[model samples]
Target: MGETVLYVCTTCRRDGDDPEGPRAGARLFDALRVRAEGAVDLRVEPVECLSVCKRPCTVAVAAADRWTYVYGDMDPAVSAEIILAGLAAYAATPDGIVPWRERPTEFKTGVIARIPPFPAPRPFPAGTPEAAE
Candidate 1:
């Protein structure tokens, strides 16, 4: 099984203020670290930027041979629960194909992008079936 990775934007700041306290992304990572300890097989790593500057708190869920989900406009305090829920759902799937209905509201509404998995070579040509007819 592939490892689920939560890519957090550590550089994101709320209200554009420099704060001594932890940023939203860092806070989310810390919270998840404690909450998911020994429960989920996932990793939370801080990233410099996801390029979604308008959205202060952003996160990306990615795994090998799976779709990558990017969500934005989040609040660490409230969003972690939904994020974790989504992660749980994603982890349960073989190819990480979590249905839209299974995803939490945060994921559904805040999604900035859903990147498809990397392409692989097709087993047979597209016209093979048609040509046989």
Candidate 2:
């Protein structure tokens, strides 16, 4: 399986947070980075924004040929472990689809979207009539 990337939105700040202070997303990224140290198959990245402005501390997990997941409403102080657990479950799967019961509670409830893989699979075999049409 390809490496899984965890993208953290660094510009997200919770409501009422000081404008000049460190963003909650940045803190969450830092926490995840620290926790993920020595991990080989997972990479943590910080992005400027994920376009989920209303939900501070947003994050996404993706891998080649696998579904991508966006999760929001994370709390920097407590969400790292939960995110890491979910990431582990995701990496264990061939198509990035973790079983609903195995997913962390936050992941089950905080999911913003689940995007299909790029170059989506064809509905019919290449030599079939459907493919010819």
Candidate 3:
């Protein structure tokens, strides 16, 4: 399997936070980076925005030929370890579909979206009637 990337939204910030201070997402990214050091299967990246402004501290996990997941409402001070644990589970799976029971509590509850793999499989085979039209 290929490396899985965890994209952290660096610009995300909670309401009422000091605008001049570091953003929650950036802090989360730093935390994850520290914990993910030397990890061979996962790469942590920072993105400017995830477009979920209402839910600060957002992240996305993705890999080729696997499902992509976005999660929101993360607590920057404490979510890094949980996120890493979830990433480990995701990396161990063949198709990035971690069993619900095995996923971290935060991942199970904070998921904002789950997208199918890029270049998703066709719903019907090329020679089938469904594909004829």
Candidate 4:
């Protein structure tokens, strides 16, 4: 798996209600990428539809097959921090549980769906995952 793992909803707000669907998700992802450097395996892909339009612009982090976290309603301001925390959790464990309380509040319960990995657009970081830029 890449250094940072990210699951992006391609058509989150397909309906009329989801204005901030993929577009907002894209911005958040771009910012996260800039902050993540390369050590964190951060892969952003648009999924067909996560089926949770209410929570448009969903984001997830999957690693070790044991834990996959899903979070939505992502405001760009917090996205970078969220991604970093998720990466830390992913890196902290052989599984992907960074303690119960320590886990991201949105993903504390876990993600809604767990899809397959992408082909590989952006490669994983070679060394340590840097802090957000």
Model 3: lDDT equals 0.93
Query: Model 2: residues >4 Å from true position, as ranges?
Result: 120-133
Model 1 lDDT per residue over 16-133, tens place? 4548787877777777677777765688888988999888689999988888889998887788777888998988887777888888888888999989887896567667985555
Give each prediction's root-mean-square deviation over alpha carbons.
Answer: 5.6, 4.0, 4.1, 12.0
TM-score of 1: 0.80
Counted clashes in each candidate structure: 0, 0, 0, 11
- Model 3: runs farther than 4 Å from truth? 120-133
Q: Write the per-residue lDDT of candidate 2 for residues 17-131, one digit (tens) a residue.
A: 7787888999999999999999988999999999999877899999999999999999999999999989989999999999999999899888999999899675898999898
Worst 10 residues of 3 by lDDT: 120-129
All candidates' TM-scores?
Answer: 0.80, 0.87, 0.87, 0.61
Enumerate residue pairs that collide in model 2: none
1-133: candidate 4 lDDT, tens digit per residue = 4355676665554234446444655556667767766554556554665566677667777764555667777665565777677677677676555676776765554346544534355655667464232
Question: Scored by CA lDDT, what does every candidate get?
Answer: 0.82, 0.93, 0.93, 0.62
Higher-lDDT candidate among 1 and 4? 1
Question: Where does the lowest 10-residue lDDT sum fall in candidate 4?
Answer: 13-22
Q: Tell me the spans in candidate 1 whose CA falls farther than 4 Å from its real position.
A: 16-18, 121-133
For model 3, what is the error of residue 67's alpha carbon versus the real structure, in angstroms, after optimal superposition? 0.2
